[model samples]
Target: MRLFAVLLLALLPSLGQAAFRCGTGLVDEGDWPVEVEERCGEPDYVAVYPEASLPGIGIVQTVEHWYYNPGPSSFIRRLVFRNGRLQSEDSLGYGFLPGAAGDCNPRVLNEGMSEFEVVRRCGEPLSKRVTWVASDAYSRYSERRSGLQGVYPVEEWMYEFGSNQFRRIVTFRDGRITDVESAGKPQ
Candidate 1:
């Protein structure tokens, strides 16, 4: 019985794929946006990516990430939707109280952090710029046969700490931070 229970516990993650509770309700992959909204209520933040076009599929899917911060006692949840269906879910570090400013320490910022994580820790930026870059998909049979996978959005967010501090610019690609740089104070 003990071995059986342990095996079951080990397999549970594979069995469930991924899911999270919303009050008394549960949201899982493949759930519709409306159902998630109904179960989880409004999200704290939402990021929408431009439509991705496959080689033969035309413009078949649009991607969005909805972030929910259920206060300081719980972990933040990020629900990813593609074409109106929940494709996956992620749990961020921790939730923060609504309307409270996040820690804006520039030293704490680093690469590979998700957009939600940045927002959770640093709050909103002073200004933002967005652009789309083309990503390539290679053929399985031949590496030479490359095609346009899709255009992914890249965003640069600027944060100003104080007059004595240099402004920091954080760049994100595919929802993850790729670079952080400093610029002179605004004139």
Candidate 2:
């Protein structure tokens, strides 16, 4: 039973492909190479990332993350995908600790919440109204703040939106968060 369970656990990753979404430019394993302009909004890092071979399949991907607290950690969840499958989801600690995720949940942004409001809670939106032309998808992103100097740096917070409410949130640095997509109330 234990051996079977372990095997199932290993195979589970290949299954449930729905949990994974391929990025634009670099289509899953086969299509054209994905462009950085399409993924990371407006190129603003110490150095721009270059295109590389897909990690698993033939897809292309870019990795960005946040850096922050206990474990003195990094929220910058790293990942890259070139094909219809996932290249990686190398995030630390499942997007935030249990209690922390709960604390971060504040209602999803609606008519009242301004850009500044979003920043107040989660820091800066990594990509504002980030849109992908090929599939007609979009995401609004943000990152958690970093700690004081000499501490862990690179804290990140992400909020992805499709038209409006997205289903994914990621912290690149050391930031943590609870699901906010559900204010759970009616719009």
Candidate 3:
């Protein structure tokens, strides 16, 4: 378990300077296997960490973290795998704990995080749930994608979870947010 958490952190460029989170994100599902040599590369994740989004079914995820040998002052990379697949494949970026080492695959989000920043860390939203007349809601927008690697537009945000210091980020596609909920305390 310790080794797996380390590899997840090492993947985040920002967190690269410190340790990383565990494999809190999804990995692979359906047709993709845990083939590090095939899935990792380009964009954000490598052939090793392929995520699958299937609601309550496919939630497979993997993360590469880091570890430091206090004695030798050396760093090592580790990988962790989780079952099931999420719905979104692309990630915006990630949220990390300040001084908590690398981007340790933040199992839980930190206190402050923004929609843009979340996108930078994780990828885009594959799908979302939306509702009008609600301050805390998600909107979605999409492009006319019609190819294998379709340039599908994706975005999301969390409304209820935003206030003072903490907020919920909703994802957006063209100009709307998807299904979102709150999960933090107000500043």
Candidate 4:
């Protein structure tokens, strides 16, 4: 009986994939994002990541995470969107009520930090872009003359906290934060 209980516990996570229900509406994995939104109404939070690759072809798949908190009795449901379609759903176990957390501060941002840490500290960016940066930007001028000729991809994230707050641009190279720049003035 103990072994059977353990097996059932292990299977609990898998059971969550069995379609998402909101009120009287039902949403499945392959449903479009519009359908879920219509059923669940506007979500509490919406985060979008710029681009991702899909199978076969190189597509600009806009990946997004939609967070919904139905009520105090329901868990937080995170619906993943890939290319404007529902990809998956995850149960966050508990929901966060309004005003539960403080806003992220861009002033504390520093170099040599991980991407995840940046997001955790500064929240999601208003915009993001990946570009090819020349090696000379970070390499020594002497090395450039010595024939180190190549470019690497770098990711830039922009944050705008409104007119009262300063905007910031965070740059990442090879998945690690390399620079942070101020783009907005304090009011």
Per-residue lDDT over 67-160 for candidate 3, one digit per residue giving the tens place of the 0 to 100 score:
1111123222223323322212222223333233333123333433333333334444323443222122111121112111212323344433
**Tens digit per residue, CA lDDT, model 1, 74-127:** 888888887789988877776878878767688978998778878777888999
How many clashes in each structure? 0, 44, 76, 0
Off by over 4 Å in 4: 1-15, 53-59, 71-74, 99-187
lDDT of 2 by residue, 35-126 (tens): 33344333111111212222244313333321212222433233333222234333343233322432123344433232222443454554
Q: Give model 4's clash tally.
A: 0
| Runs in model 2 lying further than 4 Å from the true structure | 1-10, 13-48, 51-76, 81-86, 93-187
lDDT of candidate 4 over 1-187, digit per residue (tens)? 9999999999977766767677688888878878887888887777665443323454334557777765457676777776677877776544445544534677667787545445545677889987744445553442343243344345899987678777888987534578989886645
What is the Cα-based TM-score of model 2? 0.19
Clashing pairs in 1: none
Task: Tell me, by lDDT, which candidate is best.
Answer: 1
lDDT of each: 0.77, 0.32, 0.32, 0.66
C-alpha lDDT (0 to 100) for residue 152 of candidate 1 = 46
Give the better candidate number (3 or 4) by TM-score: 4
Query: What TM-score does model 4 achieve against the real structure?
Result: 0.47
- Model 4 clashing residue pairs (backbone): none
Name model 3 segments beyond 4 Å from true: 1-33, 37-145, 148-155, 159-169, 174-187
